[model samples]
Target chain A: MITFGKGNLRVPKWSKRVFMVAAGCSPFRKYFPEYKLEELVMMGYKMMLEDNNLKLSPLEIKDSIQFAVYGQFADHFQDQLLCEAKIHDYLGLDPLYNVGIKTGGATGGTSILMGAQAIASGYANCCLVAGWERMDEVDTRTGNFYISTAACKDFETRMGRIYSSYYAPMANRFAWAYGLSDQVRAKIAIKNRHYATMNPNAQQPGDHTEEEVLSSRMSAYPLRFLECCAMTAGSASVLLCDEEMAYKLSDHPVEVFICGGSHTLRVADRRPMDIPLLPNEKPGMYDEFLKKNPRWPGFESFLAARFAAYLIYRMAGIKEPIEELDLVELHDAFTISDVQTYGDIGLRPYGQEVDYVESGDAYYGGKCPSNLSGGLLGTMHAVGATGIWQAAEVFWQLQNRYDYIHGDPKWWKRAGKKKPKNWKSLQVKDPKQGLWVSHAGVGSHVTVGILRKAW
Target chain B: MAKPAYEKAITTKYIGTPLKLHDEKPAWVIESPRAMTHIHTYGLLTPFFEGLTKGKLMATKCVNPKCPQGSTWLPPRADCPDCYERMKWVKVPSVGTIYSFTLVDYAGIGIEMKTPYWQIDVAIKGVDTIFKGYLESGKPEIGMKVKAKFRTEKPTHTILDVCWVPA
Candidate 1:
């Protein structure tokens, strides 16, 4: 049994407050041969410097940066090592110390966490966090194999040479244990893909019906092709600053609260333990849940996500997440993964995750809409870029520029696509706070970050 | 006179095949093929894989009394995570109940088994953790009883050596 000591229970406290000033990302696609990896990173980097309405000039901001952090998931995919040095030098920020962060799919969020820590620790007044993945370097199956190796090579990777097979068993167990249905799973795909229709950066946008999702090609039993995010080639970036540098950088700066948690690499090795309570939950709230589910985070749930949420909610001092957070950008790598986070993050109590979507809380114009940027399911899952893109989406929404960023014809032209005449604005009205979950390797590493509007 | 004349002068040539161009549309994308074999050691867990080929399932158990959990591990670990103590190998029952299952229709590159196979996670009584294996030939469901079937004749010597069949 894994028990948290008093030291472990202590919430993370920053030496100084951290703030996010700007965010940017390139249009995502399954294959991007038009630009080299460095050039693609430049595309997003330039957007962050120029487009976010920062007070300082792009070069002035560059001159102000004290350090940089890059997140790239796998060297096998890149076929090159020390990509940070190349990217750092390419960005014209030579001689500035930079480090690379890798935590599977959570690399992006972890990079941001590192950047935020630099600001929080007074190590840097201004820090740059950028992440990217070029999955098109290999064919789809080879890419999947590389990703699957992230699973425990000895135990799990040999069982199913694909990642979806890893999640499909969980889906089966969850459906059996919680009385969840295939219909509920299909709805998520339809919703996220439909939401993708509005995203210029979305790689796969469609107005798919429930039938279409249900009838799609099966990757694993009960999980169709559309239920999973495809490999993407793109990059995303965000800038973090200390409190003093925040107002100097932008008229709209967002306060950042982020913390991470990790569990065993093998899902089978997860020992049952007490569900760490969120700030709003009570001591015995999950007692009945424990009695029913037995294993608190069995194949059905993620302890890493739960643990991260447990710490972040307390660190951010959020009492009721469903009520407090205005909008959310979840790591919807898979539909089930998206739904599973609802309970883990206290969006719903343990047994009522489906109700979050059923109750319309996860939809646009709902109580707390999620994945308003179409999420990983719709837009992209350039593994390392995903979490940064999620944060950028929330940052833009909090800035009330969702329409300008996502709805403008200029962005459409940049992506080489015509803006749809029926494009709908997914802007959450004047948002105060939002949260995003960056997860990796069957809930191996997860970071829950909250971005509160601080103008 | 400076050099005592090397037995064979160092000579190298481009014996490697030219890497094929993957795509040449906007940017010249070249295919860089990587073929490698990792020297993996089972180490203390060698007995577990070796036992699979011998029609036995070996698990590692922590016998320390001070340890909070005296758990047995399949995909047996050398040390107990709870107390950081070395665990001893023990034989576990080869039968288990299906806790969960899935049919993998399409898989990644380098998949050994044939497609549309049932992969099951089996929960043995003594083992604290569920073990994953493929069902040999049968439909799978939760709570279905299954027993281990090893590949003894021509052992793959991998985890694939041990599979499950309907009990």
Candidate 2:
């Protein structure tokens, strides 16, 4: 098996501590026609600056911003190139110099990574990390085609033009390799969509049954429509700063530790390699299991996610992730991806991913409950904005303000929806730490971030 | 009423057709696209695509003695990823096991294949990477034996040019 070099395995370090003080997102929808893309961005940006009970005024916070990082996944969907310039000017942050980040579905997490880098490097004391996507302009099939282009055009894109077709193979292989059932995947869809009932910004929240999810029209066989995240339009943002600025902005600031890892864009190219161990894992822990399935990442797991978790667990000094993390927000772009990640991030060991969901640990009020934000499955897969929204949800949960942000009537009204009479809070009780995983392109890129409440 | 001279005389009249608005209530939303074209190139990997039409499954391998890995790759890259050196072309065995498979029932717009077909990732012999292709016939399951069936008669010149059938 191929092994990593010593230099390749060094844990990442930052010169300064980073914290996230505030996050905001526009109400997500399958088709948001009331506002332009810039307007949606302004809505989220304004919410971050004005709401969240920040100590500084919106104008003052705008004044304090030194640099900006923007994430927009596909120019083809938005039909506009250089969208960062338009969004930056619309937010009235002129001449502040902004950089655009693109990492497919991981753009939002990568944007935060960029913004945090500026803070950690002492480049900017306060930085803005914003992300947006406008996919309503295109029909669903066209949008799927646009997304599939993210796959390798020559060898893969045409084989199945939809992203689900790409992930479906992994789902099938995962089921074969580890005996994953369509039932387990359906349960994830049900749980996340049920959680979406509490999220005002959710796009496809539904109280679905396993029968409904399994019976839903097939995108690629065994992967029903309900199991996949649909195209959406929305925006989300977060403000990152150094330690001093974080405390100055809010009485409750969360410490941020984020790291990223990437694999080959095409799954066809992921060569056999040794499985990198997480902080809690021992050297030879996977030896017995590897005897049967020698392919390390094999179609069943995401190496990028495992590599990211390997780094962040060490950097943040996290050892038992399933117990230490109060809540988690997985990409959930597909149910199989979410289930596969249980092993990759050490929430569960490899081959036991199905048990993570079956044990009820992945549900509300369970140990390290996942996708409390409704996830990309039920909420918004507005591509670029998805990762940012996950962080926003985690930030709110960590601040103990899930009710104020999600249960309030104003937010429901703002989204042009009547608040359900029985809006139950999925808030983790007094959560101290939460983690969000932003993933892209069948495990090509993944970022695992932990937010610890520092109040 | 007049000749609208400035529109035509000074500049070409708006030759573009009026874009149809999908929504006009809270906001005007328009979805208009005439057409688009992208001139993509196979570049150095042209030989791999050409081999499909010639009924040959060609792969590239790293021959550098200093390289850590020297395995052949289908969907071949012109350069070896480990050594960062030019690779040499070589014919490979077309038979492989089905490492994985997916039945694509729904596809994106302009998909070349018909809907509800078996798409398979084959673990070809001697190739370090699994090659993605479609199964022209037979049900696909892990460990199912399959052999390459090239479109030697009429070529699409795409990855579609090569498919697999139960051996």
Candidate 3:
């Protein structure tokens, strides 16, 4: 961990608020307004852009803005040279020199961390990160086909499932192995949306009843449309700068610091071709394969959470159970993902984390208030940008900038005298540790990262 | 359709017994991305890959002729990490049958494939190995012989060559 002295550079306390800035997100629903899914997503993106004062065409703005960072574009960003050129032209920044794109799930948080690190290292006086994706340009099925490539397409998709199906294999494994219930997975969905209702930036908003989430149309046996995140066109950006530059540049600056980052791959991801349904190595025998790679029984969502948490804790140096943290921002790509991440992250023992949601501990104003920024479930999922966006929310919460449109809580009790603070501080109570968890699954490819507030 | 490698014998109990599966004698070889010294990054290789275009399957083989695990590298590798040798290129068979399968209803972020279809694990003969691929036609069942077929927008260079078919 690194810390800068006030003497390093000083403009004003207000500038201290954002000595370094990071990330701007645009969640676009206007482009696909006919669907409720699209509308919620649009609102989410719009809120992100509006909060940042970011007004530029995606092309004109690709990399020219302060602390320039952008999302994945198959034709543009995918082509490193084109992306590099766009960065130079739009942000007037040389990516090869100081710019680059960090994509995939949780990319939003990773990018923010990248920019934050640059600022912390004094590599740049100011930096910016932004991500957005528009699903309206293509029909749902076509868009999904492209997205499915993120997983082990040949193995997972060919086996009758897309990326989401990958989670099912795990979900099945978890359910079979740990005895987790579908109802528990449903609680994750309800809790996430419950928190999302407090987050104005979220694409989907509602105080989802547990019954509604459980009974909603099952996209898969254990997952419902309510359980999955909506495809959204939105962008988010954050600016970062050294304390002195930040002091001079803006008021209400949030001090940004990164604790740590780590990444790991899952089993199916390790082997694509011949990724056996079962891994027993017997020649001329299919039965052996099935026996070795028994369909992982149980809910994948819970498993994802547990694995993610495990990785996060390992990186963040938290020996205590992860539930100790005050806030969490998981991928929640699907509601089940939230349950899995919670368990995977070790917030609760296996098969027990979903109870955290029921206890309201994962809810806004509850202990740990997860996805207070309305997670991917409420926030549109722009692939790599999703994680980066989670990081921004953590930064905002730590800085206590909950009043902005981007800072609205995902839920609120109508009768409460005052709205809840977007920020929740465990530091005052624990004073030792705070953690953030983020995850991404591209087909069979899954990676998790954890961040801690610098002490 | 070819007769299965196994013929259900008088003793049906033996059928329920699990058998060990191994890569066929000739290891499946697929093309390697020459630019990448190791396994080619999927995104970067898509442009140069011919799998999508020729309706063929591609993968890399261990460069080290001496490595014992050379035959096990799927998606092909450019080098044998264990022995540190550059890999040779090879093409996998496009034909095979459903070894097993699953249906995915819900997809993750950025996924579009819908539910209620088969995701089959097919075995290619020339490549002589099982590869997971979509079966556009026919339900997935053990010993359901199938062949690889290509999609409409066949990119001259891609891995989505022959999709699985019920032969």
Candidate 4:
């Protein structure tokens, strides 16, 4: 590993392998009144130490942990700026560098990135990244208020618009442009619920019929209550260290490499299209396209995820993402968001995700299995912790140690009796690469990482 | 695919019974009085609100010939994004087209909107920026022409001081 010093400091190359040797998470629940944030964080940390399987003594392991990074959002319910320091004290670690990150839903992914950077820069031999959210402490009204803080306070919240309303327009425009029907959207919900039944940690587990999803109560016109993720309280964490240190700590190490990240423009400053249509098009065609196509300026929420994915692929030297990567963990806060992300990440062309979803290419045992851990839609969504959980799932998949829980037998038969194949099993058969992506704040900020299994 | 051995079922325990309302007040109601505060916008954005209170829509345009992007900007900024030069504020027409819209079906904290209210993102006729506001009347349609309706009787010095209407 490259070490930083007064005169030896140099830009580290992306070729360096920053291995994630240990990962842990608390059972995601709809509510958690019995556990405090510190208790949850300590639970994850202790679990990580146990999972590490290090032969060293407790003091040795503690000395190896050079720093810690905490990710969270909505400080109104907890300690705001001092949360990292508070966690440091609670963990009883030697004085080391610690900081907190707040990037809406991308907090977890950002924290992981920060931890990797710390190890790569030689600032620390090992770094602990943790994220948690206690949304169940507040009621729906208070939760809505807290979540709305991510949006433009002067424009969106001021005009009585929530995240559902913000994402509804994009969903409508994509449906209109791609000729997608309500049934297509319902299918996504059903698919996630199907996988959720296999994830014991999932908040909502069971089979949901397409009709059931279509008839669900509508929150915003295009987005229904069933189509959105459940509010959950949980914590997720991962331990990052240098390649040598990882080998010394764990037998199975997943090498994680951050490709890149990007942020989009403000909601008010953005236009429908960042790039105008061809001049060869007939008069008023651009205007008509803009009317039907919801484009945002500087990578509006939908485009931001796509842009980040493309940048990551480019940085990681991945020419064909679908063929090169074995699996993907997309941020699926909303079904439409997940579907559009498939197209944005270059798995399919724009407006062609409907064909991909229908072709079973995105399903387990299909061309590219996504969100085998029940995703945010099936698994609960605990804002800051969701992204880190995605990364941890990927690490498990790379190590070929992921577990699956089968859903109801009746629903399984209805879904063609095809058991959901764990991508980790496939990796064991033909080991390769995987990816994790997440975004926050109405798609203003996005983070993407590519991971590979180290033999 | 092989089915893995199921582990012991994991569950969460609640510290107390689910919270219930004792009186007619909603479960989410704060027992103590809480003060709602306004976020003050300053610096380059002060004039934008000043124009709203005066029943006018203002935008900024970069006149530098050397600047690559000499386009006009709504929600006016002090400097050109491309050239980093001072941009002069200019009055623009209130008419525009609905770029996109969504009907709010649920109301939450800090929102006085009734159910099924319309929110539109309008692309101004001359300005290059898209402004978000609520519709006064008629159902929202993409590409529908709209005009700004300023709150003349009482101005709040906020973006809500202006609403959109079918033109």
Query: For candidate 1, lDDT tens digit of each residue in A92-120?
Result: 99999999999999999999999999999
- Worst ten-residue run, lDDT, model 3 chain B? B27-36
Model 1: DockQ against the native? Answer: 0.78
Q: Lowest lDDT 10-mer window, candidate 3 chain A?
A: A272-281
lDDT of 1 by residue, B61-166 (tens): 9999999888888879999988999999999999999989989998999998999899999999889888888999899999999999999889987899999999
lDDT of 3 at A99: 52
At residue A248, what lDDT does model 1 achieve?
Answer: 97
Q: Report the Cα lDDT for residue A274, model 3.
A: 25
lDDT of each: 0.91, 0.91, 0.50, 0.71
TM-score of chain A for each candidate?
A: 0.99, 0.99, 0.68, 0.85
lDDT of candidate 3 over A1-455, digit per residue (tens): 01223552222112222243333444434243333322333333334334543344333333333455554433322224444344334433544354555445655555655666565555556666555455544445545555555555433443432455555444544555456687877767766666665554556766777788877865654567787787665555555666565444445455543322222222331322221111112344434533544432122332333333434444444565544566767677865566666554556643465577767777656767677676777656765456556766775565455445443433232112234454332222321234555455531223443333332
Q: Give the TM-score of candidate 3.
A: 0.60
Q: State every prediction's TM-score relative to the real structure.
A: 0.98, 0.98, 0.60, 0.84
DockQ of each: 0.78, 0.68, 0.10, 0.26
Give lDDT tens digits, candidate 2, residues A1-455.
25689998888888999999999999999888889999999999988997899999999999999999999999998788899999999999999999999999999999999999999999999999999999988889988899999999999999989999899989999998899988999999999999998888899999999999999999997899999998999999999999999999999999999999999989988888889988778999899989978987978899999999999999999999988999999999999999999999999999899989999999998998999888999989988888888999999999999999999999999999999988998878999998999999989999999999998
Candidate 1 Cα RMSD after full superposition onto the native fold (Å): 1.7
Q: Give candidate 2's TM-score.
A: 0.98
